[model samples]
Target: MIQDYLRQQVESKDYQPVFYDLKNAQDLHTFEALLKSRPYIRINDEIYSQLRELMKIRNPTKRLTAAEYDEKVQAYLDGVEIEKFGVWVYYPWNNQVVHLVNEADFIELRTSRNQHKITAAEIAVLSKKKIGIVGLSVGQSIALTLVMERLCGELRLADFDRLELTNMNRIRCGVHNLQVPKVVIAAREIAELDPFIKVKIYEDGMTEANMDDFFTAGGVLDIFIEECDGVDIKILSRIKAKELKIPVVMEMNDRGMIDIERFDLEPERPLMHGLIPEVDIPTLRGLTDAEKLPIFSPMLALDNASARMKFSLGEIGKTITTWPQLASSVVLGGALVADTCRRIALDQFKNSGRYYVDFEQLIV
Candidate 1:
């Protein structure tokens, strides 16, 4: 009985944020109970601040008196009806309750600055799209950027690895998150950023068994981001993406090399831009991590890799554990991915090919 108790897994609900519309008597009761059960901080000032910014967006040409602005902000609140105003967000992971305006007003105020750049119409279209990112180390930054831009309504994250001290160099998170599953850390951070984004996690990582479901279970992903370390999974994922007509995007932290496979447009295109030959899933699956390194190097496009990166690769297993990655490179990769995915989803870029944003050559 003790062993069974110890083996029980944490419930998925704990990782997600719950909303409370205090106007509803039942939800209000639950909210009160939650506060009593766990130590929680109430944060409602942001809602009024949201109202203040929203007033500016609506009246961009006006320069009103302090009294006028305060009144304007109050006009939307309708005079202190906390129960009926905005929303009460309860995050179980951190036990913090945040007060936020309704979705429409919150988005308007939050993304107001993004106006001319993203356009209100584009934001609306992007909000309907869904993206899936596999692997959470570097994928963490990419996923966060996508959410920050409100580029997608939902994000599906998959990772079987947990945070470690070494990952701290690249993956952004507090040491408190050490040993926690990467998906959990990303989900909690996303929740804190925007409770509206629907995040689905595959703690078990991507595999042939769940690949189909991961791509389509919550509606076919508009874009799929692959950043895992396993060669077998990479091959398997592209095969599935091709079969499902989903475009796949990736970045190598080495030479700023970005790879895009427009399977949705060219169904017959070869995997890895014809660099990798036809592969047998079972055969690739049977290869161990050490054995898969030979196959993975080709995907790196070594001829373009920086000389230092080449030397670093040679150091693997001899002087170091594995390929080296820096926080800057990971963050840069994230930006490249988020921008590319957004453009593709918005129909701004087309065609399948390899591109590089290498700073070494461009900086000079």
Candidate 2:
């Protein structure tokens, strides 16, 4: 288990990410060269807006002599550190350093290769695939995992709420990132990791207005991962996947085990297969809060609004916390989601629908 290795504090320097600080002019120049050789940052709409503004300032296209480039670098440094310029510099030919920056004039940059266990050929297949994620919490993990795997050519992330301190336990972000919408965060993280990826994030709540984003005349989504806690969201997603002849998969964290469901590829699936004949989009989308109340209330039985209110006033001293569930479940759920995606992307698995597990049982 990763916990064991983490607890042991095993030393493996090679696995550590190297950070090079731009301390001097020489370091700055070296870093610039490194950045120039580094890859471009890929982004969806929100991030594209930010990068577009920077691109206008540092157009890399025209002509800049070494002296001119240096002048621009110094000017940029006046506002931000040379290290904070946001560029990835690496050489494909000799593995040497080059310069890259968020404000560079270049319209595009080199593509980054996936560093996970999966291979380029595997990613090539994923790039041709499209998937939609529902519910921004677990969906956030699914997004990061897929991006890290470099799986999925185009990703569609849907969520309504912005990041909050409550999400820090399960979501991969810091307080600095609080208030950033999940859609924006997902897009930025992808671009920061590899600018070559294609990401489309829907910050607005998914509804009839934007259902087309998931499936347009351009292309039908290849797969759907339902993470929305709303039963309506699942109903809608399953319906759409079935109508489009796309497959749908969903994962839920039950204690420590993950509950996985695959619909459309199998004959008798639960929830997803329950709504439509092989699942229809509208039926899925039409699910209501009332219907979900029963399904979710049980999971939240430990929580009490009165107790929570009392705790807020220091009466109960804060008894309820998501940390236990978040730590044991969220990360594992993400890993399982990624592994399942890898299998699906590689054409290695067809198992589907309503699977669950608990990690404590395994440990015991």
Candidate 3:
């Protein structure tokens, strides 16, 4: 009976975090009531360490003795209203409550190491930009890196697939999460890593229904990342991106190949750099994976793919189930996409074209 209940309700369970402001008496009372109701709620209070690091960043010119540092820490702690110092985030799924410094101090302390390299001004600039990623297999790495660095103020995610056992080879997540939607996993991870970043989920994945809103609902995206498996969706996305003049970034996830189309820079630029002939979206749909390979190969740039990757592609129907990917390659693609997006968001990289970061070629 218990197993049946869990199987029925797990998919509909809420994954989003809830924030409570202890500064409000009503909220405080509710939180206290929650504490009484669930006495075993895990507590994670790390605001003191955050305050300590925040002090160092704020006073780079001042050298402090151990005693003085502690004194300063205590003084700051005493001055602020402890309850209002940060937020109490409750993760209902795990029955855990985490205390974190507010967005400003939290972001500053978390990304202090990126200073000068990212500059305080650049961080502010990045905080105002919005980024959308349509696939979460390899895009999972890209999204995580983006949140870790606080790259964008808002991140829009779209993925309709669920976490399968086979995805364990590349996508990082616990086995317990098997059968959960990929977007939920990505969103939950983002909420835990940095609550400051706004993550919008397209649970149905990228479809014509939500494409417009995905790009422009809250605000137009500064960058659009495409990583889904559907050939029709890929073509449609580029067409929409071209129409909106939004730049598109895609990583082939093999031999470190990445493509950047600056439709925002050159609106008239051909879709997929004119690599594939135009086709109607309805005709592209309803085709088998084998039938889609002709159009898919060109978009994936399979002609120049690594030799092993090419062989793996050929064995899809015989030996392997599909294109084989490694954790290493997916992570590498994540770094590549994140860096390119950051530079583009900051106007550091302007030209649009395909580029390679092939480790095999660069290492030797």
Point to the candidate with the largest lDDT: 3
Error of 3 at 125 (Å): 0.5
Q: Which 10 residues in a row give candidate 1 its minimum summed lDDT?
A: 39-48
Q: Give per-residue CA lDDT, model 2, range 1-364, as digits (tens).
A: 9998769963221211123335556766765665566646221223333334343344646766556656655665577654445544332222333234442222222222242455546655776787777777777777777777667767787888888887877888767667778777776666556555566777775666687776653477767777775555555665566566566666555543343445446534544434223434445444444443444443333232233322432422245332122544666777788778778757788775444455455559
By TM-score: ranked, best first:
3, 1, 2
lDDT of 3 by residue, 1-364 (tens): 9998878874554567888888888988998999999999999887777777777878899987778777887787777676567889998877899988878878788778998889999999999999999999889999998888889999999999999999989998899889899999999888888877888899999999999999899889999999988888888898889999999999989989899999999999999888866777799877766677788888778889999987887777787677888999899989999999999999999888889999999999
Task: Give the whole-model CA lDDT for all candidates, comma-separated.
Answer: 0.85, 0.57, 0.88
lDDT assessment of candidate 3: 0.88
Task: Give the runs in model 3 whose Cα sits over 4 Å from its true position.
Answer: 1-12, 74-78, 81-84
Q: Write the per-residue lDDT of candidate 1 for residues 1-364, one digit (tens) a residue.
A: 9889958955443678889888889998998888777754555546666777778789989887778878887777777684458888987676678888899887787688888889999999998999999999889999999988888999999999988999999999999787899999999998888899899999999987899999999699989999998777898898889999899999888667889999988999988898875556677765654566677777768767899877877777788877788898899998999999989999898878889988988998
Please report the candidate that would top TM-score against the real structure.
3
